[model samples]
Target: MKLTALLLSLSLTASAAIAQSDAASEARDAARDLEEAAVALQQAESSRNRIKALTQVVQSYEDGLAALREGLRRAVIRQQRLEAQLVQQEAEIARLIGVLQTLGNNNSPTLFLHPQGPTGTARAGMMLADVMPALNAEAAELRDALQEVRILRELQLGAADTLQSGLDGAQAARTALSKAISDRTDPPKRFIEDPVQTALLIAATETLEGFASGLTDMSPEPEGLAPLPDISHRRGKLDLPLEAEILLYPDETDASGVTRPGITLATRANTLVSSPVAATIRYRGPLLDLDNVMVLEPQPGLLFVFAGLGAVFGEVGEVIPTGAPLGLMGGNDPKIDAILSQSGEGSGQDRTETLYIEVRDGKTPVDPSEWFNINKDR
Candidate 1:
């Protein structure tokens, strides 16, 4: 009886161990599935966002081209008018030259004809002196008019070149966007039918702060997640997401006297936005007045908030490498818009859109300028 009981206990213990191993395997597989689903969904969303931004870029280019063409037309017209006036001035100078030559040629003859009179000679000399200054003035005026015409012609040529460049850029952007859209693979089937998480995302659309705080509760914490690098030591060493100028600094008050806790960057519409550091996306959505905002966590207790996006990419729980493309700015850039609107404006002022970024050490907001490589001027 003792031998039989010992054998039975060994069998039970072996069976229990097997069951535990199987349970662990199943849990790991389930976690893998969840991660895969999340990644697939984020990829799809990123592709969609890219397509949208590219579309906007095409539209902006079209509008910009139209504006440029109109400006060129005006410039051409002005040049034509100036050329006509220039020609008239040239003819007037020619006539004056002939008159002066005739006077010079007749000077000796006039003196011979008026041999008995010194008064006539003195009067002729005075007249010649007076006419010389007027002639010189006319010649100077003609030269000035010619220079103006030349400048206008050059401006017209420059406008044509700029317009062509813009057209080419737009076409290239469109082709890339189209190819990307076409090559996109569909996300996993399970991600599409997830109504619970979908409902939470939809409901959390009221404000950015709310969405950011509630993101932790929307899904289970990811397993085997890697930690990001320490940002506190990387001040001034960090790369900016986009090439931009700092428009507003933290602690600075705006026209409304509202002090800001973050910095605002002046960037170009359609310029690439990117991750400033390696981090997981905590929140990405439109907020009350901030447009689209992306909340990223680079460390356990630090969060980076970016706003004023026309389009956003990435999903919550997705890890992003530093300098990865995030999205693009929206709207016809005021600077670019102005460039298109005004004649003689260079393309250099394309930096127009604004991005607002805030850094939070846990729940407290801190100045982002300390953590980022801020360009004071573009």
Candidate 2:
């Protein structure tokens, strides 16, 4: 009876061990699924951002077109008025010519010699001189009017041509924007998982296994496991001197597949924030009269700024870490606090008007959403 009891006890221990192992395996699988879901969410956010940027571009172009159309309308009215004045001046000149012809017939030398006395002839000569000056003045005024009309007509034609060109440009911009919006709104055909995330999961799985073993053995688990940052480093990690969030996403596209990044955080006066990745600083200065604007490189990539947390931080060029306090939230502009990214296809210069952010591996830009925790639900 004692031997049978020992065997049963051993079997029960074996089954318990199997159950624990199975649970660990299930947990690891769940972790993987979670990671994949995160990636998908990032991709969706990227698509949304692209569409937004294109919408802005389209709206801007449309505004310009409207302004041009208004100007064109005004030009047409002015041109017509000038044309009418020119016709009226020509008619007046014709009437003056007829008067001059009648006067010439009456005052001709032959008419003066045949019937007119000396006093009448002398009076006719004086009248002729007076009329000659008036005729010349009228002729000069008509010529001036015609010249003015010609100049105005040329200007009108040029303006019309310019309006047509502007319309063409606006239409092209709208078409491009429409195509971009469509692409972004469309569901992603391919889903990409972050390799770094996969590696992290694998490491976590191994660590969890060790922790479970320690618990089973009644031993202490290893201390000091790295904690995840509150803000997920889903966007490619940047080792920048300044800390801030991406405010806008790029949606506009140029010939090159690059996007422009913009910043909303108010940096210290003249703070030199470097690029998150290795690229040139395309622009560094005030944007729209607001001080502390800096754009960074890698064709189309991240923008960084060292915000002046009044009384705490000094001016620009001061390096800060990824989460270091650059400045407090409130700024003069109420809407400047939001973070965004740009992603369509253009350089930062091409997209300087809007904010943009990008995730890249070395030189190639990847969707930042994959690497950064962009709160998609919000």
Candidate 3:
């Protein structure tokens, strides 16, 4: 009976160990699943942000163009009215010239004496004298009106021409803005799928299963490992292509403060760099002002990666993955370095050149430091 008790005790100990192992495995699996779910959420949010930004830009261009067109229409109408007034003034001048000629013919001294008696001639002369000054004054007034109309017409025409020019410029601007908006709209065409989240999810799931399997193997009375909890049931848990870093932080004074978050990234080159959160190809082509731009969405917005020693990606809209090779660190401008050094001098910190990396949650710029694990020293 003592021998039997010893065997039972050994069996019990083994069973307890197996139970502990299974529990640990279960916790690990849960953690992995949570990480995956977080990644998916990030991707979804990134895509959504991109779409929102493109839409706003396109709408702004449309609204501006519409306003310009309306102004042009009003200008054209004013021009037409001025042109009509000019025509009327010219006709009145011609009528005045005809009246002056008729009076001159009737008042001639040879015709005045031959055609009529002394009394009639005297009366005609008085009438011509009285009317001549009035006719001359009236003619002069009509001529002045004609000149005024011409001046007014010229001014209106100039205004119309200016409006037309503005309209043409607006059209060009709208086309460019439209193209940019279109490039960002269709996701599949522009955005290369980054499978980082998906891969992490799969690996996490497999690791969990392996742990459970190991526990089962150690158990003497090996029933298959206890069933894992179902993670698939969780909502918002498996979206992919989530953003992993923010390169630029928003500024407090920008329009983003009202609608989305404002970003501090400047339009100047080398102000920031970013992980486009998708798989992309490097465009090693001709350099332009917009060089080092990665095309995150092939059809939509181009993510410009600035070039310095740190400004690595050179090509317009080249595709790149999250945390991929951006470029080496360097400062494009000396002033920025000096400013950094001055700020750090007070704290006895050495001035260092840093790369600007930005993650645009669509059009809204968010602080990338929030998402990326930049604390390598830690």
Candidate 4:
């Protein structure tokens, strides 16, 4: 009875939630996806492509966690809105409660009395027949509202367990993938780098543009390196390194008045950053302000610079196959309470970490939005 009363206190919130079809859909989808990843995590160790398998597992957990956050966000909004409605409807609710209390009194003298005689009683009976269906419908809705409260209560309890399981599974998968990257010696080396010149070049340059200008000339010195594939035909259609990704364009200025070149993407915690196309790693690791950068040369003059990675994989001058894991973005997944309490416009504004992507066709910077379809994907 105590539990029931508590749930009733939240009845309006749950009732509002019930009206929105997908209020809990994301939560359910997240649970199902995380559960599936748990099953796959067991087999990932023995799989032929452990890197890919484990990568998928981490991705699943991240995706599930993202969905779970959204579910909780919607729930918070629903409760707030419903609570406001309750304030507005307080008088009506009080009247209904009074009616209910009167109904509960079994010994009321006027319960079966009518003001008028035979014909009036007959008319009243007809009126009562008409009112019964609507009253029954209201009772049914109240019952459903109560049931929804129970479901929401159950979901809140389950979410704590879901969050813990997801965190463990995601961390385990990342550890396995990191090991796989470390143990592998199979990636075809494009050429041996004479880092002496590159290091000298880095020491001379203050900005990425200067280093890149020098790299354009120095990187071509390697002889007999196989030519990379032409992505000219695939100019507008390139796969993103992060899934369910959001992007910001160069034109959109932040609070401070400054413009940025290329496009920026927000990635999930330790999300697998992949090569969009077959390319050679011109340089990997940190340079300038960008932490743990990976620069790729798809063609002689075409360069793609990915920066702010937590970890970079593959060596300088190594051939990276398309969709190969480049590295991971730094950070741990959000906590269970954090996920529930997160609020803002939506997921776009909630991203805390950033991935800087700059593409240069020659000396001129290419807008990465050309390669990544933000409208279609985001």
TM-score for each candidate, following the candidate numbering: 0.53, 0.26, 0.22, 0.84
Tens digit per residue, CA lDDT, model 2, 260-326: 3322221222122223433322233333323333333232223333222221221222222233222
lDDT of 3 at 323: 37
| Model 3 misplaced stretches (Cα beyond 4 Å) | 1-108, 113-116, 164-378
Residue 350 in candidate 1, Cα distance off native in Å: 5.8
lDDT per model vs. reference: 0.59, 0.35, 0.35, 0.73
Consecutive 10-residue window with the lowest summed lDDT within model 4: 1-10
The better-scoring model by TM-score among 1 and 2 is 1
Residue-level lDDT of model 3, residues 1-378, one tens digit each, is 232333334334323322211222232333333334334333433454543333333233323322333333333343344445545444444554565567466866665562568887787678667655655554454455445445434533443343343334333433333343345533222223234532443344433223222222221221232322332242223211211222334343434442223222222212223333443432322123222323232112222222222334323223334433333233332232332223212321222332233333334444434443332232
Query: How much does candidate 4 score in TM-score?
Result: 0.84
Q: After superposition, how far is residue 280 of candidate 3 from its true place, in Å?
A: 42
The lDDT, on a scale of 0 to 1, for candidate 3 is 0.35
Error of 3 at 344 (Å): 65
| Predicted candidate 1 versus true structure: per-residue lDDT over 104-146, tens digit per residue | 6885664334453788667656756665565455455545556
User: Highest lDDT among the candidates is held by which one?
Assistant: 4
RMSD of 4: 5.4
lDDT of 4 by residue, 9-64 (tens): 44554355346435566778888888898899999989998888877787787787
Residue pairs of candidate 1 with colliding backbone atoms: none
How many clashes in each candidate?
A: 0, 29, 34, 0
Candidate 3: 10-residue stretch with minimal lDDT: 235-244
Best by TM-score: 4
Q: In model 1, where is the ten-residue run with the lowest total lDDT?
A: 16-25
